[model samples]
Target: MSEEEHQHPTSHYVKIWAILLVLLAVSVTGPMLEIQWVTLLTAFGIAGVKAYMVAVKFMHIDQTPRFVTYLVTTTLVFMLLFFAGTAPDVMKDHGTNWEKPAWIAAEAAYAAGEVSHEPEHH
Candidate 1:
């Protein structure tokens, strides 16, 4: 029908916006703590929450037909598969008939403490 027919009160969307903002702040600040597990958790966890909120409240995806939900789920699954299939190749330092000498040099320098690209923990 119309926006008013499907939408919640203004305060409801505003509250969701405020929650998303707070989550954004948490995700941005979380990595600064430099704990690997905490960083991963906060990054992915807050991101998933924010994505769901935007989908349900702003996009009104939940109001759509059940088939739409299945479509979205399938799309996300394919995306995950695509990423998983490519990530190992992308992360490799060398590949068939190709090498990254400059990156290797940079890594060597960082390891030797000659070039300080990585932030020192103090």
Candidate 2:
């Protein structure tokens, strides 16, 4: 084996272990935090950081070429944008604008053969 291959240090693994420990501690005691939004944000942020660390160090993707990294980054970016853009439509104030159309009931009646047409004579 060449010296260059052997030069791949083990400190990355140690860093990964340390990050995993912190993530585990947070997961175990996360419910005890009372800061609400701040707590949630911090937890998510830490989780993202830990995931990135694991992907780069343990998965050895950090050694991958730049194009592959850009492809992964672009995919994540587009996914986040799609989620952000569509979430509001799902959680909006759709009061009277949400009512069903009268044509729907008419269609049901028509399908059931319940329609009636009468002519008045004077």
Candidate 3:
């Protein structure tokens, strides 16, 4: 097959770029509407669309073997799983055996309109 057979016209790329720019504009403006669901929709949903476009069009991942896509997807799942497994521990302020007194104090102070002290880590 010739290179021309695999090549798209410059106009095609320009059109794709224009659409991506429009999506970018929408995503950027989404947060300013001050709606939580709408903000998340544009931030994550439109970003996902932009990522798919870049991967399929620019990277030509569509032409790759199916397993490459599977690998990427599996990796993403594992990353999410790791975050899920660790996030609770990371976010907790206290437990039965241990506590975060400094952080808790600092947060309470800040909330009550007092000067906040930095938490000490050991």
Candidate 4:
């Protein structure tokens, strides 16, 4: 193979550096925001953008066959869907229903023999 076959010119390096700068900016600004939801969304969005840049441009994903690329992309999409779909539920406040009133509930349970108050040795 000739040198031409292996050559990726300086422009490719420049593009990578440009993307790196954007990624760096995002990394720096992401944590400085005070609004919780906006900050969370911004950080995740920046991460997704940076990941796409790295996967496509640096990883040479465009050189792969269409089916292989589609398969990988689809798998990642499903993985993101799984995570995103669960974040709110996992972060939600399920409220006092899941929590005991401590005094009344514990005492009632103990009186009813529904619970044992004996201390277990660690």
Candidate 5:
């Protein structure tokens, strides 16, 4: 690739940096704003923008081959799928639902006094 194709002006980098910093500030203060959906949306949205900037500017993903772009998109899709599949368990209240076999076993052991409430010494 020519130097011209590979090189970005300092001003471009500065602009992207400034945008990322503003997004970072928004993400940091999002939770304190006391709106759960707004906080989550802002955090995730800003994170996506930051990731896109890093990929396009730092990693040069936008100049990459079409196959490479497809590969990256596929990887991101799979990651979203993995997170979605596990989100229910992560968000669920384990204390209220002891349906898992491990939880049931632990409860049984506690009832039988096989599991001690006190801490063990070395």
Candidate 6:
């Protein structure tokens, strides 16, 4: 086999492992800092980096075909799009303080005791 096809050096893997360990430590200790936004951003940012490392190294996605890489990229893009599309609705307030229409009708009938077993003529 060609030298280019061979796996990366042991030192490279060790370096990646060390970096991942550091990222893990940061993520674990981030919340303890109590900085709120900084902690959350740091944790998520470190997690994304760790995930990318694992995908490239352990999963060997880096050595995969172009199509496989494109597929993964496309999937991530679609996931982001889905989240973005739903975010507005999720964050918006529709002002639904009033009772539901069906529930209101049912409550009115219940209060009037209109729910009888006898048939009602039009």
Q: Which prediction has the highest TM-score against the true structure?
A: 1
Model 1 agreement with the true structure over 5-115: per-residue lDDT tens digits: 776888988999999999999999999999999899899999999998898788878778789989988999999999999988887778998878887887888799888
- At residue 109, give the lDDT of candidate 1: 81
Q: How does each model score on lDDT?
A: 0.87, 0.71, 0.85, 0.73, 0.83, 0.80
Pairs clashing within candidate 1: none
Global CA lDDT of candidate 2, please?
A: 0.71
Give the winner by lDDT.
Answer: 1
Model 3, runs deviating above 4 Å: 1-6, 95-106, 113-122
Task: Please say which candidate is ahead in lDDT: 2 or 6.
Answer: 6
lDDT of 5 by residue, 1-122 (tens): 98697778899889988988998999999977869898887888879889999998878787777899999999999999999998878655364545567776777888998888655621
Backbone clashes in each candidate structure, one number apiece? 0, 0, 0, 0, 0, 0
Tell me the tens digit of each residue's lDDT in model 3 across 1-122.
56676777889888989999999999999988979999999999999999989888877666567888888779879999999998887778887688899878877878996764434421
Listed in order, each prediction's TM-score against the native is: 0.81, 0.60, 0.70, 0.53, 0.64, 0.63
Model 1: which ten-residue window has the lowest total lDDT? 113-122
Error in Å for residue 52 of model 5: 1.6
Evaluate model 6: give its TM-score.
0.63
Superposed model 5: Cα runs more than 4 Å off = 1-3, 87-122
C-alpha RMSD by candidate, in order: 2.9, 15.2, 5.7, 10.9, 7.9, 13.4
Regions of candidate 4 where Cα sits further than 4 Å from its true position: 1-7, 81-122
Off by over 4 Å in 6: 1-4, 9-14, 91-122
Give the clash count for model 2: 0
Report the candidate with higher lDDT, 4 versus 6.
6
| TM value for model 4 | 0.53
Q: Give the lDDT of residue 85 in candidate 6.
A: 93
What ranking of all candidate models by TM-score puts the best one first?
Answer: 1, 3, 5, 6, 2, 4
Error of 4 at 100 (Å): 14
